[model samples]
Target: MHIEDLAVPSVNMVRWGAPKQWLFVTPEQENVRAFEEKCRETFPWRKQARRPQRAATHCSQFVRHANVLVTTEALLDWGIDFSETICREGELVVTLPGTYHQVVNMGENLAEAVNVMWGNCGQVQSTYVCCSRDGCGHTGGVSQEDLTPEVASQ
Candidate 1:
């Protein structure tokens, strides 16, 4: 439900324990809109709020509490194309910019992640603009504090 840093790529290395299942959705406008609508329907309170926080897009908590998986087939029906992968112990996973992704650990897991900025300045600047417009707290090096209404309005 959330994207990694928009200007950087994230590398994840699983050192031990069980495998991790990852689901990714491309950052297409239609796909993101469909997923957001699904989230609002699943969590009705999100639709009731005047200005719901974007954190609601994080579906891991919902899946854990509701004990329901948002299946790939359902997403496909909603016109969302996705990619799935399983990363086992000692395996590495790399996520590129602008891709929304979710991860579920099959069991206990030990993993480490690092973000690397390798894009040109223009590309980085473009991501900053896109993230800012999208109100994406995790992207373009934006910190949570920067997303506050007061700060965001400035």
Candidate 2:
């Protein structure tokens, strides 16, 4: 459940993976809130850790729960509109900025991805916290002190 770099689009080529499932959702506040709520409900243990929301990266709890595969019925119940696709071998998947996405490999497979920034890139790099390339250390994006239940709720 993360957005790729705002300045770059992620291009993934499925060289061997067949039937890879890709899910995407447009970044909307209501959708994000619903997703976070679902995550919290799914993994109640994480509530004690007091970790800040790190939607930009596949962090611990979220990564574990991502395998649960939210059903289409649940998405509709939550009012979350999404798009999905199945990529097979020799297929290419392109992901644009500001779109939250998740991928599930149906079986063991190999794939490669690269990020490219072009003239049409819209958002500034600083708009979203990128913990992948930047030297943000292990603590994804937000600090622990910055996110309380109250702040996270808002």
The global C-alpha lDDT for each of the candidates, from Candidate 1 onward, is 0.60, 0.60
lDDT of 2: 0.60
Each candidate's number of clashing pairs is 0, 0
Write model 2 residue lDDT over 1-154, tens digit each, in one string.
5555433568887788556899877557687667757666665554333334444234423423243556667667777778899988889998886566778888978899887555545434343433332332233566543433344345
Q: Least lDDT summed over 10 consecutive residues: which range in candidate 1?
A: 121-130
Q: Cα lDDT for residue 67, model 1?
A: 28
lDDT of 1 at 113: 86
* Candidate 2 collision pairs: none
TM for candidate 2 is: 0.59
